[model samples]
Target chain A: MRRAKFKAAAVAFIASATLASATLASAPAQAEIASGAVLANTCFSCHGTDGKSAGDMPTIAGKSEDFITRKLKAFKSGELEATIMNRIAKGFTDEEIAALAKFFSRR
Target chain B: MTELTRRGFNKGLGATTALGALSLSGIAPATAAGKAQVVVVGGGFGGATAAKYIKRFDPKIGVTLVEPSKRFVTCPFSNTVIGGLNTIDYITHGYDALKGLGVEVVHDSAAAVDGAKKQVRLAGGGSIGFDRCIVAPGVDFRWEAIEGLDAGTAARIPHAWKAGAQTLLLRKQLEAMADGGVFVISPPVNPFRCPPGPGERISLVASYFKTAKPRSKIIVLDPKEKFSKEGLFKEGWAALYPGMIEYRNLAEDGLVRRVDPASRTLYTDFGEETGDVVNFIPAQKAGKIAQVSGLADKTEWCPIHPRSFESTLQPGVHVIGDASIAAPMPKSAFTASTQAKVCAEAVVNLLRGAAPGAPKFINVCYSLVGENYGISVAMVYGYRDGRIVKIEGSGGLSPSGATPEFRRKEADYTRGWYESISRDIWG
Candidate 1:
């Protein structure tokens, strides 16, 4: 009985450590998206690269992550308001939304 | 059967509710930085603001914003679409604002969020890891509660509560209605998005009909006995639209029970209502994503840290905007923006390992009654003890029936605010 308990504890610790290491590995990729210059291609159609809005488009350079996430969710859930953007936004997943927020916030 | 005290949630949330603080400890302390990656769901006023604010307060802390759309339409001024004051195009904005801010702006929906794993999984396939996460995904239409009402019924019945296409559809329906026909508008129970929204929408639509379709009448059915800006709306209804606008304050007995799309009829608990057009705004809860994430309680809303807006369900996960149980604060764009700022400040403070001081909440809701008549309310709030407490009487109605000039000035301020706030969130 003692041996079984010890084996289970060791297995749990190893699994936890593996999960922790895996989580740590992907985080830097997110950092790279924020600090690096990878997302410019996706932008500029409406916002213009410098955060200067085009026509009635909003300037989003210095916004908070929470603000951005709420708006996007509105687009997803069919709450809030949108037109064509809702159709376009239909393509992004939650992870991509996070990546976009991180990249733009860094810029 | 352990009666789920919070009827809708699992046994875990029940305990967490009894001890909201206990479960929060299992998660990383809000803003803790061990290079912790935080995931934020949604991209509206709250989600957008949280993402931008998190990065602003702490540069090293990694943040991800999961939103389904690249662009968002402004609900604040959407009524203008119905009034012919503006087009839907005028209110739309892409995620360019967030992308420019260096945010990872995803363009898809979040399928689920496993609070235990601190992961937000997308509907597509993969999932992302997070030390902390935030959800501001707005509300969903409660299609089940209303008989004979589903998305199809809404298409013909026209519930523009969600904005976007629904707003346009309601507007189009209004435009198509007979000149002398009856148009019925229903306001959902309170604590819904934009408390004064239904009132504002009715007034704006009435204003349009006054000039365009003079013979038409607008009947408003409300579930609540009272509403935001009631005194002002009543005063204006008497002076301006008079008999053209009628209101029925329906209590529980008067709840809308069924909808008939073909005849344009709404059968309420009180009686059957018929109109050339029917607009039903149903009772709502948090976004489906929030519910799936297990952040929602019996209220179908996420409970959060009053100051940080962080979700109590999962550590590092925060909720803001219409989905959160932020009382004394209406679900307005202005209120969302204010809450977003506080959440941003709290997230920043937490990330820096600095204890959050007393955080303040601010909000101002402005509504345009007639062409030039405008009314507004503003207030500031702070954390008291463990709960949120509002500073009373700090604001009031627009001086209780002020002059036309005063109302006009209020209108101007209203316009200015829309410009500034849109910039504050998207910029």
Candidate 2:
């Protein structure tokens, strides 16, 4: 039953994404959104997909954009206490951090 | 192809309605308009993750993962198996999950790569064409590095470095040894796969002896003056397994020049030493396939473009994992998987005739000092000028002088990372 739900959800997501792509095809300007999912997949190696936490790691999904941005910047700046986040955050540029913040906030 | 775009044009309808139709129909949209073929060799962390991410990025791009083995045994947690903390089955994974993501998982060895023809020849006698080839064949030992240490000798004196039969062999050797027996470990020089792996194994073995064979002692004859997480590992050895582990650096004549499996003895410049069980991890180079395929040059490791992981020696071919010389980024499983993501994106972008994007790679390696004590090192890297550069103040070792509670927490995090990374790659 869980597998069935997951497949259904996957189909729904692909369908919506396909629709979004189609809607933006006429306006190429709007199609320039960064591929957040591509980069975010790396984070799933520790944090769960879409910033969901599977273990002790904090869940970033649905967090306020400003909160996510602040935390990432702090980690990048070495102003935050973290086991691995500071290192991982340093890999991202300011633009990427903002894009990820926006992506996760929507999740 | 037109049908896909036509379906996309139905965006005039509400997203909920489109999703409802998609769910009821059980049809996944085409990933892209153009169909590109990506052939990946070696279905380990790098290859498997690359195939999955490529399909995720653009399902229209066909991905064929060529790995001889049906199931992959990971090196990350295999040390626990040697320590009897976990079973071999716990670290083994199949490619079914990757297949589910629309990747063609071919259980055949990539015998050779034809750069000009853009074809990968299989060991079974056939060639598969590819628009781009990604090779992630992990490291192979330089058999001649140590005298009298080859395949047959390695069976008796196990390396246990590749994480399958050798791991079990080492475990058996340990189990058969008598109490108070000496277990000698010969760690290879730098530029080897998993810099901290040997130290972690020693810690776990010491942990096992702490309970099972209290009188047994472990002696590490290391070639290098210092090793990854040297301070943390030494501290843990002192705190947890006092008087059980002894490390001899190169300055102290620790380098093993030769080994005699018949006598179970190691010969160093200083003198000779014998042990009941000996683990002689050898110096490493790129995998045999990479060498034969011309991906690796005289360096015995593949050089690649830092931004894309494309082979600098071979165009239209990308090399990653332990086989690739990603300097400043040690050859580690975490780095391999991270490189795979960036390589996947680069392959897709190249297929679309766009320049590859600038990439950021991160590596995190966790070492278990005891069953409940862990230490880690992490780094964030980016391509600058013409090489991979570590971002300053980005990562460091697990803090020193922490309480037991802190170490225990890091241990939990270690297990969590293992589970998460394994699932991300294969689950």
Candidate 3:
């Protein structure tokens, strides 16, 4: 069991290093689109981009990632009452929700 | 489901690697070093959002927004202005935010496009070149479709579709109306901007009558059999403004063949109807600039590739907003902004020689049925088989028997949505 856990950690480390290198490699060529920003942009139609809201809509920028994740999951599951967020949240996959949470949280 | 294992996660990354490799080969080299010129026309929701997003995606791409007007009045919440719930200034915005974002704001109309030369001619005798051009001129009324309802007559029987002086005119007419007066709203056929717009206007007018002119009646003459959020609008009308509002479908005395603006009478196939105030929303086509520039094809609107929103008829130019043929997705400010982002990404990817990613579009239209009562319809769209198709099991209408509290919350959401979207475009 200890050997297997060590192997898994090595594989994870290698994978992350490869991704980081690949991102750096593509940065100069401008071949990689900002996937998180592009995905988060869709919300700009109803929520300002980078989560800076203008009116009654609360800003999501700088919020805890866990808080956004919990609120989005509640919206997705229809547990929390919403006007349009429920329907919108239902459209995102779990992967997309995490990506969006990470994107907005960083802002 | 359990969390993805390391192997599974690595496999997903491997797929992304393949996609990136493909993108590297697919994109062509951009024209200039360190600065790519992206020109956007019409400074509305689509153009403004496209300009903002393109700059956000890559600061190196210099964006120039060409718009004749300095201030943009949104159509989303203009109905509330007509209903006396909000003021026009509340829906109006300026382009200062976009300018502060390093976008070159050109206060001039685009007269024509030299597509081959990759340049746009200004109406007031100037020319600007572009590496990529995005046109989002919104919609223009087809005045010839209705007899005696040209621009001059429209001043008398206001359409209030463009959300400025027309909106104020309609409000003034409503205010001048008698207590038991009749208010007539003639809605054009499908494929127009904001499908639920007429219905929402009717609700707001009814709300105003309930308080100001209780005996007043509203008549909606629709050219279609059904409308967006039909059931919800009907239910709210019945519950809130009982016996005060009447909806006539095309099959039932709804089609207005002609109008005599001098008499304030609308002649239909069934009979003649007069009103104290008339709103004649005429048939619509792509904005005049799209047609004159050869972007619009045989269809009244411009045809575009569903994925890139680039005009299929005109290369090197992208068309968005109500002017593009984006059916299944209604012609709305929200859809325009959404399409703008997708188009912006495509433009950037193509400039940088990267493959454009798959496109997903979402539309949520909220309609206020009465004071503190609203309903909505939402859908998700995916590009497949060379066309945009609705995603199954995603998005639907508001519940049929929702509580008043739910509807009131929706109303609040409507206001919030307007604030959010307006700021996204102009703030």
- What is the DockQ for all candidates, taken in turn? 0.02, 0.19, 0.33
Writing each residue's lDDT as its tens digit, candidate 1 over B1-427 gives 1112112221232233324323644543333336757677887777877777667656666778887766788788888787778898877877776676677877778998876666888887899987657778888877787788888877888888876898899888899988998899888886789887887888888899999999999888777888998988778777778789878886544467787889988887768879887888888888898888788888888898675677876656678889888886778776665576566654554443332323445466778888687777655454444456665434445667667877777676566556655665676
Tens digits of per-residue lDDT, candidate 2, B49-73, equal 8998888777878999999999999
Q: Assess candidate 3 and give its TM-score to the true structure.
A: 0.88
DockQ of 3: 0.33
Which stretches in model 1 have alpha-carbon errors above 4 Å?
A1-107, B1-35, B251-254
Which regions in candidate 2 have their CA more than 4 angstroms from the true location?
A1-35, A76-79, A90-93, B1-34
Interface RMSD of each: 15.6, 9.9, 6.5
lDDT, candidate 3, B1-427, per-residue tens: 2123322432432344334334543433453344678899999889999999898888778899999987888888899999999999998899899989999999999998766677899998989987779999999999988988898997899999897889899999999999999999999887899999999999999999999999999888888899989999989998999999888998898999999999899999978889999999999999999999999987789998776787877667899999999888999888999999989987887566444555677788888987699899998776656677787667889988889998998887788788888888787
lDDT of 3 at A1: 100
**Pairs that collide, model 3:** B27-B353, B27-B354, B28-B353
What DockQ class does candidate 2 belong to? incorrect
lDDT of 2 by residue, A47-75 (tens): 65567756656778899978988999998
Candidate 3 lDDT over residue span A1-107, tens digit each: 97587456544533332333233323233445655566778876666667887656678988987798899999989899776677778777665666678788999
TM-score of each: 0.74, 0.86, 0.88
Candidate numbers sorted by TM-score from highest down? 3, 2, 1
- Residue B323, model 3: lDDT of 96
Query: Which tens-of-lDDT digit does each residue in A1-107 have in candidate 1?
Result: 97587456544433332222223321111111121122222233234343445434466666775576567667656686432234334444444445455445654
Top DockQ: which candidate number? 3
